[model samples]
Each structure stands twice: as structure tokens, then as C-alpha cells.
Target: MRRALLAITGLAAGTTAMVVLKGSPGAAPVAQDLPAERPTVVPAPAGPTPSGGDTAGTPQPADSTASPRPGRTATRAPTSRPSATTRAPSAPRTTTKPPPAPTTRTVTGPVVENEYGNVQVQITLSGTRIVDVVALELPEETAQSDQRSEQVDGRYSGSSGLVVQRQSADVDTVSGATATSTSYKRSLQAAIDRAN
Candidate 1:
């Protein structure tokens, strides 16, 4: 029983030593990345030929021993013929797509710090004409105290109402806010441009 136990222990130790020497735990084989072995093609051994590899230099006699057989015939030489040439049709033709329409609109205003707050303009355009115009976020205090009122007459230069004339214009600006009024007027002009 003692000998049998010794033998089993020795076998386990040997197996563990082999595994460590082979580096099998998460270690790749040394020759795994090398290119695969392939068969080498060797050219056949050739002997020297007569006539110096050229049959045209020296013409052999008809009845000479070096001549070919009587029945077999040599192949004919290759020939070259005229190739066909095609010409495209001559015509003034063009196929092009039209440019896309502009879909974005923008409005500009001034930066004015009034007694109430900052001032900015609001403009609304419909197509090429000014459809709507308004002051952006007016102060509640100014609206109550100003009491601005005006009557403006508009006339078209031509038969179409493309142009207009303001007969009477009344405007009310903040106590120290002329810039705010200018910004509002700029917004109105932007709206008019949208209308045209």
C-alpha cells in the first residue's frame, strides 16, 4: 500500500512538471504563428538543344536527318484584322435638376438696456412680404404709462399693393430708450420685406 501511494504521487508530480515545462496554461505554442509548410516545386532538368534555340539562322537541307516527319503540318501564323469603331450620337442635350428652395428665415434687432429691461424686436414674414410685426416682450409699466396711439395711411405705388406710404406715424419710446424704438422699427421693416 505504501509503494502504491508513492507511485501515484510520483505520477502526479511528473504530469505537473510536464504541464509547466510545456507552458500550456494560457500560453500559445511557439510555432503556432509560423506560415504553413508547403511543397517546393523544382524545375525539370533540361539538356542542350541543337540549332542554338533558333531555327531561322541556319536552314537545314530537305533530305537531312534533322528534318521533321513527312505527314504532320506546322501551324499557321496569327493574323490581325481591322477592329470596329463606334461613334456616339452628336446632339445638344442636357439633363439637370433644378436648385432647391430656401426654407429658413431670420430677423435682426438691437441690444438696448432700458429702465424696465433689455429690448429686442420681433418680425414675422409671409413668403416675400411682412405679414406681422410686434415688439418682443414690452415692459408692463411702460405699456400702461406711455398710452401710444397713431393713424398711418398706406398707398400702393402701382396697381398691386406691393408698395405703401405711411401718412401719419406716432411712436412712443421709453424715457431713456431710443435704441428700443429703433429696434422695434427695424423689426417692422423686416416684416414689410417679408410681405414684398
Candidate 2:
């Protein structure tokens, strides 16, 4: 694509130069930006040599090794032509798509402290759906508190747990574990909020 554009722009500039500097045969080349050297000598027009590139003012040779078409004669055609193997490129056709972002992630809520102990919750989510909940910490200060924490953890945290089944912090509180249950729900809500 780039080479084609350069070729086209080069030819346009060469045409403009020939028209503008018609009589000044020795003036600078008006062909497009060739490097220190041009790709090849393009054929000159039939009317007369452009003086932009073809050896200035001199009559160009009708016979040459570059292109020796039998009928070509007398015209100031350039000596070199594009090689046979060189072909114009076509635009690409494939479409590209980027991979999708990960949908499953785990989020941990801040540790919430209450009179009984500190409670922290973690939740795994698949897109907007809650997949599981886990109790990272709970009150282990006393035997009764430990049993209550276990009761709360068992009721609320798992793949098929009540928390996932309810999909919210509004699970039924255990009868004797009100404080732990409330703390657990608070931590779970915070984790869910952070995940969203």
C-alpha cells in the first residue's frame, strides 16, 4: 500500500515538473523523492522528453536493453521499466479481534471488628453472579464463639451455600449466633461491593 502511494505521488510530481519546467532541460529532477538514486528510469511521454529525468535535452535512444519493444521508436521513452517479477500489492482482507477479559475473580472484603471478634469475608464471582463465599476469619475467642462462628461459616460459605443461593447478604441468621451472623453479613456485603 505504501509503495503504491509513493509510486503514484512520484508520477504526479514528475508530470507537474515536466509541465512547469518545460524549457529548462538542465534544471533539477522534479520526480518524486527518489533516494540518492531513482528506482528505475520510467518511460518519457511521446510528445517530447520531460527534461525532469531523461538525460536532459538529449534525444533519448529508441533502442535499449531495458525494454526493446519492436514497434517502439523515435519517442523519448525511458530506458528502464519495472521488472517482470514486481507486481502491485493488494489490500489485506483478514479481520482481527482481541481476546475477552477474564470473567471469574475473587474479592476479599475488609475485616470488620465487632464486640465478639473480627470477621472477614471473601467471595468468588463469575461475571456479575456470585459463585461462592468464604469466611477468612471469625471470632475464636471462646468455645461458644468458636461453635457460633462455625455455624455461621457453614451456613453462609460454599459453592452451593446459602449465601450463593440467596446471591446477597440477606441470609437467615443463626438462632444463637446473632452477632457473628451480623458481622459475617457486613463483611460479605463489603466484599460484594468491592467486587462490583
Top-TM-score candidate index: 2
Residue-level lDDT of model 1, residues 71-144, one tens digit each, is 43333345675556655668988888786663444443443455644544444443444333335544336553
* Cα-based lDDT at residue 58, candidate 1: 43
For model 1, the stretches where C-alpha displacement exceeds 4 angstroms are: 1-88, 108-110, 115-117, 124-134, 143-146, 149-180, 186-196
lDDT for each residue of candidate 2 in 25-128, tens digit (9 for 90 to 100)? 68776666545322334555568656567565564543444554443333344679899999889788888888676599999998989889999999999888
Q: Return the lDDT, model 1, position 8.
A: 100
Error of 1 at 148 (Å): 3.1
10 residues in a row with least lDDT, candidate 2 = 33-42
Task: State the C-alpha lDDT per candidate.
Answer: 0.43, 0.84
